[model samples]
Target: MRNTLLVLLFMAVNTISYSQNQFTGIVKDAENGEPVFSANVYFPTLEKGDITGEDGRFEIGNLPAGNYKLVISSIGYTSYTTEINIPAEEFEILLTPSAIEMEEVIVSTPFHQLQSENVMKVERESISELNKNGAVTLSDGITQIAGVESVTTGTGIGKPVIRGLSSNRVLVYTQGIRLENQQYGEEHGLGISSMGIGSVEVIKGPASLLYGSDAIGGVLYLNPELYASSGETNGELRTDYFTNTRGYQSSLMAKTSGEKLKFLARGSIAAHSDYKTGNYERVTNTRFSEKDLKAGIGFQDQKYKADLRYNFNRSEIGIPEEIGIQSTRKLPLLPNQVIDNHVLSLDNKFYFKNSSLDFRVGYQFNDRKEFEEHHEHEEDHEEGEEHEEEHETHEEDEDHEHEHEEHEGPALEMHLETLNYNLKYNLPKIGNFEIITGVQGMYQTNDNFGEEILIPNAETFDFGIYTTAHYHISNWDFQGGLRFDHRDLQTEQTLSEGQLIEGIDRSFNSVNGAFGVKYKFGEKFTGRLNLASGFRAPNLSELTSYGTHHGANRFEIGNPDLDNEQNFQVDLALEYRNQHFEVFANAFRNSISNYIFINPTGEEIDGEAVFEYDQQNAMLYGGEAGIHIHPHPLDWLHLESSFQTVTGELENGGYLPLIPANSLTNTFRVELENIGRNLVSSYSFIRLRSVFDQNNPGSFETETPGYSLLSAGIGTGVKLDEFMLDLRLSGNNLLNESYISHLSRLKPDGIQNIGRNIMLSATISL
Candidate 1:
């Protein structure tokens, strides 16, 4: 890893002759041919972009000689996207004036098409937009999107659930590489921070054809922040304060871009005290603190481009049991977790006139430690004991050993390391057909370091190969793909004073495929149909665990004979849009064979309930529908409503565990182009969120009642001389509702979620 880092740094500093190719264009309004100033013109593939000048002219120099997708966008006007060849003649681009939101390129899927042109129905959200909606964390923000939910242990730890599946089922990608950080654990949160993230794209259904195993449920793709434009240097400072947790977050970012090299760095820190409930009672030991640093460097020439990104994150989070303490403490107490993660990724692209090759590699190291309250055992010695000298010597040795054991080491510790690589080749376009073939895989190893072990030391190896294609004909788009994956798992045998365990070696193979069609019905309606298959191999814990998992408060037993889980899903989506209104609906039904889950055995081990891994057939169905309205005459006023629901059931009977309740959300918003003399833009919004009752509980699970929450926020951008400042004030749970989420791990203890929270944030651009 050290050698690789040095090589990457050397490449970033080395320079070559610049290419003479340059692209220039002018952006104008379609209605009156008026120049559109300050419009963003970008090439997603090259990681290069330019802003239109006052005269609407933009120039991008030193571009590789190849075909690239060009996107031009500005506020209050429809975005323009098209395929353009480098070194082509200068041209004029016209954008239509519209009230609808501008479309962004979808990076999760192949072809990198806009959502409107994608065959798959993907949800995309920007970090800035999520923050404006009063989201406290990246996971909390994603719940605002339809068809998505989270299994939360607290505000600091959350596992994303897509369409009722979570844990090892959903795969997360960052910086163009797979993120492998012990995701099999439900208490593990998404380690990637939102500080340097530009946006997030979600693939809601089976994506095995694109990602491989573990993507049977879906995928979360996080795009990193873009580098500064050529010859530009920029800096930003952002800060936020929250009332409920007495939490504060701050970040500093700086970037500079040369003609051939670009570099960026960001540092962020956050700390929060125990959160309070609606009754103003603090949840003891729920405090958390985080520190993060992200950096990136990129170098490009005529034929090749390379980008290297690195992130290091450290977090200390407390585990709340019964809410005993009432003080606002920022540091976590015993029964807490300390985690450190390091992620490094390097992406390289080779451009060849009509085709391109992309190679990406990533390395991740995760160190997780859990500390539990310690108790000392007392031994009594009789006054008139025989062999007094021997007894004294034994007691002295025992005391020394006890002293060493009391040195404050973690009760449980694990180190996970992963190395993954991806290679894709874009074939030359044949008429209207475009195809891409890729190979993706990873090698991982997990080691135990502490006194307690939830899972034995194990090694995993994965290899996959896939091919996908896209074709455009008339008003219809067709896409299909096929993939094959193989995984190998091996564990070491261990023998203890009271227990004997045998090691096992297992191998699994799977073949998956996906097909989809998208059609445009005239100018206002669009429809899509998709069918896909996916699979996931059993994780280490599911195959070798034999002890208690303190994080979940249960003793678990693994099943080494578990089979691979395979699933098939069918999805349908429809959309209607016009000058005043936009509506969309998405539906999906999934069937799985050999679905794996943990079942209570009605047994106890050492005072803890025992659970064992089991497998059964299951089915899941869900849909999401939403509408946005901007009255023609009152474009500043907007009304939006959305509803999402999903149900999961075992083949024999009962419902699946951790399923999210049906939810509905409505928002009323008003936008002002200019609020005052210094305020250039402003917006305010109020939202009502409702969760319906969840009576369909799985085995050992109880029913949960529904609840409603009210929230509102206002934000504005202020212009001061040549600098820009953004300010926002938001409140969540304004009604102070005392409610518990169906997927909350703390719900069984009758603990309510965080109550009314007021947040104030500001960002200054220099």
Candidate 2:
């Protein structure tokens, strides 16, 4: 009888075990047949799942033995689901396009437009690219998103341009604060830098509602890393040493978590003397060096959480000092150009049962100093000999006269101080209806004491308030926002005549807004229509400036009576995603009223050509589309490719200046696992880039030619360990291409980029 009881017990245990079963599978792209790495695989019944590893492999243990449904998803791709009967062994699965079911969901939206219904596009194109500058900081990264172009400086600075709008027409924000820096002047374009950003979000079109003025081009939001609710912290330390570039950089970041408090701290140090050209020649001051540091701390609870952050950045960079003789120009890339920044912010999130509040207040101060030695050209020329007689040799003779030693005409020190505050709230009063309102105020001052032009001192005050609403009703999503701005500027200057031009004041007030509606069909498809109106009051530098533009090597003259430039935009977007693939397309048209532009009057007034700032009606239009095919057939690697183009026309039908031509970027990455003791390898399989030259050269501009660049990266044998290493090998203008960028100086010809170079990087965790 005991033996019979034991048999019955064993049977009962087996029956219970049989109730649960395990499921395993591999995922791949349908078109290219590549394995999907890091693809999300989830089971509704299980409520948890694992991501695909290299070789497109995934295994889920301890699943109940029964019928189940599975979901797969990835960014920039479609989400997919399938039903299966699970036994025990591994199974291979495929996902279909989400477009079929999306057509019925045209009434749904993830976020609402702030104004009237119009089409718009939002993109995160820099997530996996190797070149960080082109992705997150300033405008360089957004240039690859269709209808976008970037105003590129040196290796370190860049800004985005949408359609044909640039400068004051663009609005760039970090997290949500309208970043403060002198973007209006190329000189200050490199001032506000983004060293460590997680992602860059781009919204193309007018964004006057939630964001005030200067949003005529588009909006670029820099997203930072956040702590999780579990109170678990994670971080990384990276160090890179490059040869041809002759630089060493080290970065450290840490995060800590607890039930109620979490914090993050990051610091980086980098210094490099100079860079070498393709011929292996040192490129002097072209090699600027510096150090950066950032820190943040926060606390979270079931209802609310708050964080505090402080950032300190100090650097001494190389600012090319160029001189022109006759028709040839030579830039001495060896001098040190110094600039530094410090910022402190307090941010908080308040949560209630059905609503939430997010707020941030911060203070920023930027101090900049520029010094240059005027190199005597040692040469002079007369106008057309016929005109020479009219011009006379007296003017030419004085030009060649011996010059006295001077400190860059006179040392000019500029100071900018800003105070900012903002608050946004979400309410559950109307179920899916939400509203956000906030205000921002700033005070900026510029002091100049130079012996040369002795530009007077200036001060600027800016204030604005904005509101936005989001409503979701059934299959449709609606969004809209409106903003009002008030600006006051004061300037004082002394002319060559020794007369004091004192206390010039200007003020402007305007309103801008955007509205859009989103529709969702079933689950796989989405479509949006958006229309927006925005404006930008003339900036301080635009209205009252007497300085030299170093990069373009031009003597800029600011227009004091300039009126506010206005923007109107319309955008259309379509999204189709599922499983291993996602395809997106965006198109837009923008029109500007009183669009400000630098027009060459040809007549040289005083010592420089009357290249005065002027305004005219303008228009811009363009579109871009892309597709993501993960794990085409391969299971251990990933590939992403994109291309963008733009076109702009002045009301007079003239093409805009300094507009970037067509460009393309392609990246390949590979990740490994389990070489030995959880060791893994991360590698950049390949990177390819191509840029078209700006053949639409201006009167003072020289034509440029298109070129291509190729690069590759390889890492150490193990990545899973606390320490990982990477080596990068690259060649810019690989063909030894001698092509000048659109922003090159206007002389006989233009300068070229570094010929070729190599670099290596490493990261560690504790």
Candidate 3:
């Protein structure tokens, strides 16, 4: 691992080179051919950008020979994007007046196109809209998206499930880097705060050609807040409160930019008490708290760009068991967790005459500790029997050592470190085609420092190379790509009871590809069809775990010879849009070979049931449909409805576990424009969601009952001179309905989901 880090660092330093490539352009207003000054010009793919001078002229040099996307934007103009071939000497660009809301741009995929222009369809949501739904956590907010669900252990721990797959099947990307925080664990959460994020994008099908392994289900890409415009400074303060858990959250952010330099900083704190059920009964030991901080800086010139960012997060969460006494205590009892995470990233881009080169490196560290009560046996708890013989015997008995301090430290502690690297080159365009080639890799290590051992100490190395292309012809776009990946894993040897336990050393490789096309039937209709193949290497836990899992109260045995799980999927999407109405539908089918899962052995080990990891062929299919309409006479009144369904089954027979039940949701929203004397904008909405009963459950899984939930919210924004004040009030399950979610891990414990949550938040921007 050390050698790998050194090599990556060396490459980052040596990748820079001086070239004669140069690009120059002039920006002007579309309505009037007047020069637009100080406009920001950038290349999302290359990460090299510049600001137009006072004369509306910009120049960048040392560019590599390649095809790139150039984005131009200003404070009062709509963002403009177009494909640029580097060798061109000078060019002219125009910006139009900013519309009420411009089409969102997606950065997760390589295309970097607007939502309406991309060959593949992706779902997007802004942070403000996510908060309007009154969710307590980031994962909770994401569940509002159709076809997306979360697997929850408690109120504070959640793992995203896409198209009925999760736990090492779904991938998460943040800060332009992959997140590696022991995602294979069921109790592990996303470990990210939504404060510093600007928006989120989701791809509902296989994306392995873009993001290596574990993208079989999908990818969740988080886009950080953009820096303030050139020569401008801005800041915001916000606070929130939730009644269900008595939680409070606060955050502050500041950003500034200059001609060639930019910087940003943010901090947030949150705390919550135990959550209450529909019957107003407290579920004890469900409390959690978090502290997060982030900072970033960047420097840009005509030909070179460099940016660095770091984030630190600390969280303390409690694990819930049987219902205990209802209390408002802030601290939890025994059986809790302390997690700390740190991420650092650097992005560099170099521009040549007709192409560009990009290099990104990231380092992440995660420390997780689980604490539980340690009870001593009667013989070991002896005290006050101070006879000379007894004292001598106790002193000589090695087993009695540290008997009084058994409960002082955590029962299980694991530290994980990961380093990731990527190098990509944008090849010069060929006729009407754009091409990209890249190499991605990672090196990781995990070590245990406590009594409990879930998985053995291990080291993993991964590498992949891919090539993708986009071809444009009239009103149709074509995209396809292929990738090859290899992974090697090794675990340290261990001994139990003076007997050697076999060590594992293995390697796996695979080939994957994707092809997709987008066609515009007319001005108001578009359609997309994509077919992709993805794979997931057996995780460390599935291959090396051999011990008691305290969180699940079971003994687990791993299969050292487990092979990679490969999947092939087909996705179809259709959409129609006009001024006042829009509708969309997405459908997909996936087949997997060697799907890894735990199987009950019908045996007991030291009073705990034994389960072993195994493999089987599986299939999944699902679709989501939705429509939004605004009546002509009452444009302020909006109506929307959506339905989502998915099912997974083994090739032989039974269904899969943790599959979300078929569900439908509807919303009625009203836009309050000029309703108050000082209000600039305001809105209110109500939603009715229904979940159908899950009659088809996997093996060892029971059926779930159907239920309906009601929720509503109101928000307004007031402007005072140059400052703005925003306030929102929202409620979930207003009727306090008692229901159990089919995807909740707590279902087996007979615990109902949280109910009747009232949230209030305020924000002030300057």
Best of the candidates, TM-score: 1
TM-score for candidate 1, residues paired by index: 0.93
By lDDT, the best candidate is 1
**Which stretches in model 3 have alpha-carbon errors above 4 Å?**
1-43, 46-101, 376-407, 495-500, 633-635, 672-678
| Model 3 C-alpha lDDT per residue in residues 316-427, reported as the tens digit of each score | 8888875654554546555678899998999877665556677889999999888776763224332332322343344334223332333576788889999999888877
Candidate 2 residue lDDT tens string, 1-766: 8368446744543454333345678888776678877777765433335578888878765454444446676532355665455564686755433321111100111222211122345555433242422122334445545566656544445566766566667777664466675567654454443446555666677766656667777776665554432334577777666554556667778888665566777787766544444443333344455567777776654334577877777656555432221111111222334567777778666543434556667777776655554564334442221222343344344323312222334244555666666666554435566666767666667665444342356677878887777776767887788888988888775562344444578898998878887887766678887888988888766666555554445556777889988878888877766545667777778888998888666765445555667888887777776766555444346566777666677887667776666777776756444446544544445667788776765445556787777755555445545555443343333344444466532223344555555555555655
Q: Each candidate's TM vs. the true structure?
A: 0.93, 0.75, 0.88
Q: Candidate 1 — which residues are off by over 4 angstroms?
A: 1-19, 376-407, 495-497, 674-677
Worst 10 residues of 2 by lDDT: 100-109
lDDT of 2 at 525: 77
Poorly placed runs, candidate 2 (over 4 Å): 1-120, 125-149, 192-194, 227-235, 277-283, 321-336, 374-410, 449-456, 493-499, 547-552, 605-608, 631-639, 666-677, 715-736, 744-749
Q: Of the pair 2 and 3, which is ahead by lDDT? A: 3
TM accuracy, model 2:
0.75
Ranking by TM-score: 1, 3, 2
